[model samples]
Target chain A: MSNWQWFHRLGSPRWFYYKTEGWVPWLAAVSGILLVLGTVWGLAFAPPDYQQGNSYRIIYLHVPAAFLALIGYYVMAVAGAVGMIWRMKMAFVVMKSAAPIGAALTFLSLVTGAIWGKPTWGTWWEWDARITSMLILLFLYLGIMALQAAFQSRDAADKASALLALIGTVNIPIIYKSVDWWHTLHQPATLKLTSAPTIHSSMLYPLLTMILAFYIFYALVLILYTRAEILRREGRTQWVIDLVKEEAKKP
Target chain B: MHPVRRQRLFFILFIVFFSSVAVGLMAFALRDNINLFYPPSMIVAGEVPLDRRIRAGGCVRPGSVSRDRETLETTFLLTDGIVDFRVHYTGILPDLFAEGEAAVVNGELRADGGFYATQVLAKHDEKYMPPEVAETMAAVSDGHDESCEVVQYGS
Candidate 1:
């Protein structure tokens, strides 16, 4: 019975709000410190490439943003599925919060990649398979966001956007494997789950740090957004009203 | 499980499965357009039409690049381990363009069998290393680095 307590409490908006409230400061501090450390190490300490030179340093940002964008889509889709199947409002709030963050990260990846590509690949943009598939991913994120806004009813919006998010997951595998499957100007991935990473240790370490920082940063932002969304959706509840009163009385 | 919940679960699964099948079929139908370039073997086999603007990519064959010096005209042979073809371009090459490195050229194949490229873009591999590591590997291997052997060509 005790084991299921946390799981049951996780579905409650009030419980989630109070549980994560104490974690906000810690999450912000850790992510901020790790982000600064990763960026400084990647830029100043890491060695230059033999070929691409300084332009290759952009991987610290580009790779992490791209990695999180793809992972965030899965988060959004799974949250939507949970909401649809289990009828959980918290899940729907999470799904909604994930959409804009994923879209922004995907946009970041594209812009950083274009900046890196101009000096290395001799072009700012191309309709190559990998690049085109990534662009499609960006559009998929935007489409989900747009679909959510189109419906006036929150319930209708959740259901419609959930369906679209699940459908768009098919594009994720395509984006990941496009470089390998097609003759693209975009190079293949440096990190592989099945084998050892291709990047050297000095470069790989900072990249791993940045990836960790991005994951922590994502968690912090998701929690903040979910907390705000919970308040909005549960405003009529007594606990939320009391919370608002408590906050006003503090100062 | 509740009957309604079970029914919704099945409905969601059905949508995902059928949508994946639909997308797979569409991807298969547009296969050629999705590939960025053709390899040398495809060009050698006459699978690609001549005199049409198309993209070709392969490793730049070592010791095959020649420059006119007076003009921007440069010629290089690109190889895919199986076949090799000559590419003629009259512009500045990219910074990363070098012997034994992968490159993609966009141009038309003349009836005379030479490819006249209007644009040349350098393509790098997945491997990354610091300058010192690369230099050490280059010295230890002495002109026979494993990086050159992993050149990927279009299938």
Candidate 2:
């Protein structure tokens, strides 16, 4: 098949729904295994930071979720752009699916950050630069989700939310650069691709594993979410009816 | 241009206009509220205003800490190597508070030039230097302790 042919097939909801079934179980298993192993390695086996003691263990969940929260915004913005520019139905589904997951992760990052800060910073919250920018990120996610819900027509919801996502793209860099641009209580990043990572190999390895696992986990969850969205939107179609009948016949 | 492409371009322009205006508003608000804290060196240069609430941060200079036996009030000199200043805080300090580690002390600057701190955020951990304190230290060229040394300062 031609490249364009394969591309068109990807936009087909029926092809996606049927094709993804065989892959979901495998993705779920891999995410589960890596999460378990990384959790054990980071929480139990990894040596404590000579400074923060066991309190530093919060890095295992906090860093991965924070990293993913930032990436999720980019993902949402790109999906919205594609949905708007190309008028692709699947793109909108992907874009809509990203909002709540991104919101949840942002919430996770903020709460974990506060818990980690309490023993170290002597306070649970501060209006510091990094903290404020992160709070804005969470608000952006909530805004996207709420905007989509407020519209009565689905098409209108898709277009308006897409616009909001694009407009909010500017905040991503601000969140990433807050520590550099302003005085903040947050520490500098541990993992940098430009230079060597700051952490020890014993700690870094588990962290890298957890990060990779989170990416895989994101893909797995996104696929599941998009598939459910596809079904709800396309339930009136013939293929869905046939598929449901086929399942009934099989049982 | 085709009508579909024209609509998309309009959307792109709209986003650009909206972002610039939004960012400008955020900046103005930030300017009023943002006293991101002054380094000890800024105080040494006599640049800090003593009227409003402001922040100053750095490493707690070694051998400079003292506590009153009865009141539990603590006093110490905060330093970024090039300049040193005193901080008198009455609250309980965090567990990770230590000498040689970086910290930020937030309060008003007194007439005696000492910081009368209401809150003292010590280095959360031995390895963790709050980026603000690290920035103050970097201004003096003796930039880091263990936590920030490996970090490349700018992108």
Candidate 3:
């Protein structure tokens, strides 16, 4: 089949289930390997900051987690928009699966950031613009989750949640630019397109590696959750029923 | 609502409430980050121990600045007129570090009556004040007398 033919077939629940089952284990294995390598490289091998010393090592986890949190929200919002526009049930499932994961990542970012802040900034929390905005982002995610659960009908819930996700996306750019707009204590972006990194190559290498590892881990988890969501939503279909029958027969 | 639906809603609320409390506790546990600022008089009175990491804020006393060429350490006196404390810092001074300027230093106190600073922050008034400083100013200015005049220091 052509690529477009395969793409079109993916919308079919059975086709998606069969295609993703073969890929999930490999993706999970690769994600685990990369994460371990990245952590070791960042925590042990990388040199410490001249100013912050060993405490700056937290950046390896903190920065990647924060980056993923933001990106995950965008992914969920886009998926929601697609579901709303195309009236695709699978897209809605994907959005639903992505929200909790994104919120978890956002929570992780805030926690890790606080841990890092304690040793370096001598404080656990700051109402800095970026931090405050990120907290609001978490609230938005919870709002979507709550709105979805509030409705009596599943379809109505999905539609309402999708709309909320789309509207909340307006805050993303504001969160990104808050530091520049306000006189914040939090340092400006370390990685920027216009200028070279203010860090040594030893530190930069591990940071980049950790970022790649995080992306892979995100993809791995997203695919897993998507598969689970598809199973739960499409359990009444013949393929799912047959798969369940086959499992029971094996025992 | 159905029983299952109600339970799920309760579960989510539980998570939200529990997580919020956890976050609050973490913030309180890490209160050191929020409670860093101290006046020079507090340092002199032994209210703030010299060995502990603390921030000292006051005006730099004119003619009290000296530098050691061999050690790269600089010594200066900070005063609020009620009391004064000598601050000794080793390393490059902030650009704003000069005679008669408002400054905040983060470091430990020496066995002697001086501060061995790890970080030196120079603050200017409205022109170059950080957001935190601006917020602090706003909070303090709400009902207090406005005798505190912020001076411009290094860039």
Q: Report the C-alpha displacement of residue A14, candidate 3, in angstroms.
A: 2.0
Give per-residue CA lDDT, model 2, range B1-155, as digits (tens): 56996798688768857896888578657763554567777876778888567888777776778999889899998877667899998979997787666788889887788889999986543233334544565677544455323323221
Q: Candidate 1 residues B100-124, lDDT tens each?
A: 8888999999888899999999887
lDDT (CA) for every model shown? 0.89, 0.80, 0.71
The residue-level lDDT of candidate 2 at A191 comes to 80
- Give candidate 1 misplaced runs (Cα > 4 Å): A1-3, B139-155
DockQ-based ranking, best first? 1, 2, 3
lDDT of 3 at A105: 85
| Ten-residue region with minimum lDDT total, candidate 3 chain A | A179-188
Supply candidate 2's per-residue lDDT for B23: 88
lDDT of 1 at B104: 91
lDDT of 2 at A159: 90
- In the order shown, the chain A TM-scores of the predictions are 0.97, 0.96, 0.94
User: For model 3, how does the per-residue alpha-carbon lDDT over B20-139 read when each residue is reduced to its tens digit?
Assistant: 566556545754444335777668778776588777777777677999999998888877756778888888765445567566677888778878888776532212222344456557
Which residue pairs clash in candidate 3?
A122-B33, A123-B33, B50-B109, B96-B154
Question: Would you list the rank order by lDDT, best first?
Answer: 1, 2, 3
State which candidate, 1 or 3, has the greater lDDT. Answer: 1
Cand. 2 TM to true fold: 0.88
How close to the true structure is residue A97 of candidate 1, measured as C-alpha lDDT?
Answer: 93
lDDT of 1 by residue, A1-251 (tens): 89978767889999999999999999999999999999999999999987789999999999999999999999998898888888888889999999989999999999999999888888889899888878888888898889878999999999998998888888888889888787789988899898899889999999999999999999999999999999999999999999999999996
Off by over 4 Å in 2: A246-251, B1-3, B6-10, B13-35, B44-51, B124-155
